[model samples]
Target: MLLKAKYKKNIFFFFKSLLISMQNFLKQFKPKKYKAYNKYVIVSAVYNVEKYLDDFFKSIINQRLDFKSNIYLICVDDGSTDNSANIIKKYQKKYPKNITYLYKENGGQASSRNLGLKYLKENDLNIFWVTFTDPDDFLDRDYFYEVDSFLKKQNNIAMVATNIIFY
Candidate 1:
């Protein structure tokens, strides 16, 4: 019993230390205020989304943010099992370094977003703004700029949203 208790304590301490180390590693990557551009948008794309791929990518590529201030667009290909990957590939070719990709196994939408978030967190990308865009929807150019600009200028705001229509 005495030996077992000591072993258990050692195990507990080991795990505790491991957890702290992981936290520290993540913290190191935490985003700092960009002297030039401190904001980012995490746009995600995944499998079986050919229907909405073109409009979606186009919308992002055409964002009107102050390009002088970098808007890091972190995009992902979540193990798409369709021409979805091909379409995303096209975007990759067209945009070059504009889009960042995190290709993962065949996980669902939530997984895709989670993977994207992991990349964001690991890279310490200070994203003062993020908005979800449905792969199957069309967006106006002003969507993100309006949200980001409005949020940036406001000193006392909590939440912002738009009308949603689901057929």
Candidate 2:
């Protein structure tokens, strides 16, 4: 229990920094429209992850590609005792077409991710590549562009880890 709480706190801190940084970065951003949702984004959030949502949203909105529909947003609320579910629902209503919000029983992060995957598979969403983002992590707008381009150039690649700045 102690380790879990510690990790969650660290994750929360990292997530908070990400949001603040994104807010700062968002003061100057331009969208580049794309054809469709090119990559699948798996963002798993649980109780006490509220600190990171702002940064996650900011990072996503500032993505270089213009077409917001092309990127799938899978936000799973793992039976949050807090207002996590309500928060996710708010975003879902805001993005009824592009985002998916799942509220499952109080499970851990892994279970929540599995549920998100189940939703994807059930809905028959064909994803060429997949990546994960923590509720408290921030992403660079250019990160997707660089990764997608690199993957396309190198066909045999399966999975890769780029970078993350933890608190």
Candidate 3:
């Protein structure tokens, strides 16, 4: 009986040491964790809205948040006959890092938005949130800043809506 008890204690210690060493060995092969920047992607289905395109782009560009790093704008043009595409191209040239311009045959707003989502998935951007906007709709200067603040506080939320002020 004494011999059996001693052997059991030795086996227990042996397994414990083995488990610790295995854990340490596994840690080395673990995936290296790099700091991730949570970015917000805004998708806008743009049709022929040449008149309002400047205002829309200005509102987005003038947001208080760091436009270059914090926010990304995906503008999906739905075959605009007007000079809307030209305006988008202009802005794209000016802010190439912050804006992504996609041209697709006219299929309505929903399809354009879906294409924007597909682009997001294909690129695999580190996105924390996604929201849709209209080409004619302009945002307040502090819009993205406020949204970012609220999002940081309420990470559990899936959706957020802002009061729209029709001018």
TM-score of 2: 0.73
How big is the positional error of residue 161 in model 2, measured in Å on the Cα after superposition?
1.4
Q: Please, what are the lDDT tens digits per residue for candidate 3 over residues 14-125?
A: 6676799999999988543222135688899999999999999888777767677677899999999999989999999999988999999999999999999999999988
- For each candidate in turn, the TM-score is 0.65, 0.73, 0.75
Q: Which candidate's TM-score is highest?
A: 3
Give candidate 3's TM-score: 0.75
RMSD of each: 17.5, 14.5, 18.0
Error of 1 at 46 (Å): 1.1
Query: Model-by-model lDDT, in order?
Result: 0.66, 0.72, 0.84
Ranking by lDDT: 3, 2, 1
Summed backbone clashes in each candidate are: 1, 6, 0
Q: List, residue by residue over 1-167, the lDDT tens digit for candidate 2.
A: 23455547688876676799999899677455554325656556565687678778777766775426557788888776766667777877887776788888877878877888788888888876666677777778777777767766786787878977666
Off by over 4 Å in 1: 1-38, 66-70, 156-159, 165-167
How well is each residue in 121-142 modelled by candidate 1, as lDDT tens digits?
7877666566556577766666
